[model samples]
Target: MKVKNIVRTVAAVAAGAMLIPLAACGGGTAADSGKTKITFLSWDNEQTMSPFIEEFEKENPDISIDFSYAPPTAEYIQTLQTRLVGNQAPDVFIITSENKNDLIDNGYVLDMTGKSYTEKLSQANKDFVSRDGKVYGQSISSWAAGIAYNKELLKQVGYDTVPSTWDEFLDLCKKLQDNGVSPYIEAIGDGADRIPDSFTGAILADKGIDVTTLASKDPQTPGANEKEAVKAWMKVYDEGYASRDNVGVSGDDAKTQFVNGQVAMYCTGAWDFSTFEQAGFDWGFAQIPALDKNHEQYAQGSPSPGLAIYSKLDGDKLKAAEKFLDFMVSDWSLEQRSKNGDAITVDGFESDVTEQYKDVYENNLKTGKYFLMTNFYSNPDVLISTNNAEVQQLVQGSITADQWAENIDAKMASAQ
Candidate 1:
């Protein structure tokens, strides 16, 4: 919602203040030259979403989409929040881990609980945007983050593929380090650390702990299981398998190290494919090793943010918004999304992911063997920021793994 200040004359200014909205004016269902206009605020840029919008418009000639964009994460959240608070929100917008609670508690997004289009979503995709058995968003894809190891580097260490268990993985790291290779590097400078997150998933699965149930507990104790996971993950630093300096490394820095052959493995995901492909080396991606031989392999990931209809939308405009969501799950949209490199998770649709990432695609994404701490915890933004700071201290040996977990609990309790 753009507000323009117009002061053409002193007399007009003295009379009253007049504000006019610009191109970003379509808040709800507005008639655009006799056609119902459904406003949509997209996290994706126009280039990525335009083709679908055009196709949808062509399919339903009576409904026009007043599409707008804000880049993801911070800017997108702020833009949506501002619009929602100002009572000028779009008919449709994104629902993500960062804003799901607020959106639901405030009755901002419509429940897609019994919507036919929702029936086509994968269970994991449905659960990601769901709260208390009611679905709110149409999430259609997921991404997994795990170990990306250099094939040649691992070959030098006499390993054909990444091991499936944590102990063996550490042994391999030891071998790589003994051979003068920097063993492993994962960025812990921001967000929740992926290594620990994967370990937490494995632990949770082994213990049969339901994430949703854990999420419902008090915020102070929500991350209780994370203690064991963090303790296991700390072995990398405790045993000197990974560099303590990695606490300061950014994701790009870790990727750069791997690309430069300075590190044997980097903890990342498919987003690094193009850069890895251009690095002139044979690289392979694999799910993060299980917590132990008894545990299932898991990766750190979550479904992409989902599109949700505004709860206030009704009448022809609401119908138009629903149609737009239905089109997203249509065969054409799935195929296009697959082509665009999303690991499409809509039911009956298989993404043709690249071969290097096939391990993660098959083992983690397909089976829902992935976890994200922020996705399951309360005050997600606070959880991530606090976890990042606490984990950095754990890496620096300034605090024990147990202390890290305790700190996380205390921080979350205080935040609540």
Candidate 2:
């Protein structure tokens, strides 16, 4: 679970190569034409963005677009870094917790304070855009991750509702086990799910401590709060609810098992909805189960993926970039997004969520609950992504819980 271990693995892949060529449009460049062209570099591919891009282009006919995409998460960051260094960076790009600090430190991203678009989003969403009161990136949508369960499996075990408390959840798991169900399936091998970390977040929030603060603390310190959170995860391991064999199971495998009805509950996010639906199961979503009677419900997520203008652009191109970004956040843009079956990130935009998940969306909004996977502004390069696999190993019994906590601390220390 060391950061270097994962980083090396990713860096070994062709997709991990530092300087991927931007997808070139066959049309002429900005200098040749009267129109301004702005390149949009994103992790999402052209097909995923076709609807939004089409609408934006239609509304702003004068501005042309050059769209590009890289693979998700780590590879995307490395690709963007290479682009910035070579001065071939896109006019606009995604700024997430993984690369936000490095981009800010290098002065590659534009300061968006006082922009009209920044004011258009909800205040809560706006909080994510600013660092030291200077806005940089605007989150287009919010996200949350939790247990998506197979309803029929639960009913077969004589349960109608997903458990709310950890104890009840454990009881339900036992029941599912008694009835020959795999109770829960977590992605231990993927090294990113961090199921234990999520349960720890809920535990910290329950104790009236900030989950981010807990994460920010030195994991090696072993304070009372840290121990409590660690103990919450250890309970799952000690009770045999989770397995060490999961250390070899990837996220896709877990999803497949859940979809195949091999497991009752799968820990994941709303992003997995399409995968599950395609899996063809009678499934539904729920918040992460509470840790205890006193614990408040909580779920882990990432900041809405944002589109930010790169600092290097100027003149008509700058104006074009602004126009494109504005269109991206506009109501018209949101409507198109809804129609295309994209996930909702903005407050007022309607979602393309399946009818079965309407209640899940409503409940998340009603509770005002969210926890980012990485704190974009606060600890951008702190190696939060590598801890999941280690935690998974601990749950699956490949590694001890103490070793998992220590591994996280080691990564944070190295990053510092």
Candidate 3:
């Protein structure tokens, strides 16, 4: 995972490409070096993936790995897409809601059904791995999305506990606002951001709807349940709870504001630990408040980062790729992940999460309430992108609740 090692590997690969014709004349395949090397392309930079890679290499001396990382989700997606199309894809890659379909549809990823690695996952973990009954990825962990609040802010508002009902939440927000604090701060510029934490929860609570199903539909003809979910989201706008100014706020901006004590609560995922730790405040986490008293306590999330093998790999290289992936889901890998604050998904591997966020992981464990965000589960990327823009506009007061919902519907339709 060292940057230098990565640079060397990439350089070697580039050089190999240039030498392909020469090597062809010399009558040696790239695999002729007598070692099985599986190239892994990760969205996580080299530093984060280094320890795990080291562990895998130490355990399997017969197989060597070369890793290349692209920046995060966006750049990684573009890079992998190009690589796959060019037949220069890495032997193993990270798969997520964003690029799973493209990989599966184009046959870039291997079908992992009945593989030994697939059997190691629990049934719940299996759900995200399969598409139309064909498995393509191994979901490593699960996460929860909700509110992270400053305990001091709640105390100032005369509350010892985070509100569980929308009504009380609004009242709390109003109190915080009166006290010269931004009651709630969220990244609303992208439809896929805030909705997953707030309105998406409301939608799940309202009708027991599965966001994935609705998102999978023709965007133009979003089901009645999906529309209702959008309506519930608008309630935040109607009540002046979430701000329209958030349209200008990036995720980093919102996190900074929350950490600096400018905001009382932030709606985001469990992954914001680094941000919260830097904030000089006493904080607590909780599930998204339920909609009314009848709604279940639901939050949005997805399987954490996971591994996929490229379909192009065959024979010994394919076997080595599969071995590395299996190593990733082993008990040791889970323990490493737990120690690193990863939420647990594989059965029998519990999280050793930090004390501050223990409640967050505990709630996810207890309720089994973790659900992937709508955009992650949906198709045509445009739906998620458009919805993100429209939601940001809605938060900024540039658009009405009806307009926001209409925009969502329009995007969904156009995608179809």
lDDT of 1 by residue, 262-343 (tens): 9999888887889999988898988899988778899988888899999999999899999999999999999998888789
List TM-scores for all candidates, in order: 0.90, 0.80, 0.80
**Better TM-score candidate (1, 2):** 1
Off by over 4 Å in 1: 1-32
Candidate 3 per-residue C-alpha lDDT over 131-216 given as tens digits, one digit per residue, 9 for 90 to 100? 66667888766776678888888899798767887777888888888888778877764333543344454556466554445435
Model 2 TM-score on a 0 to 1 scale:
0.80
Candidate achieving the largest TM-score:
1
Looking at candidate 3, the ten consecutive residues that score lowest on lDDT are 1-10
How does each model score on lDDT? 0.81, 0.66, 0.66
lDDT of 3 at 46: 64
Which of candidates 1 and 3 reaches a greater TM-score?
A: 1
Residue 380, candidate 3: C-alpha displacement in angstroms: 5.1
Error of 1 at 302 (Å): 1.1
Best by lDDT: 1
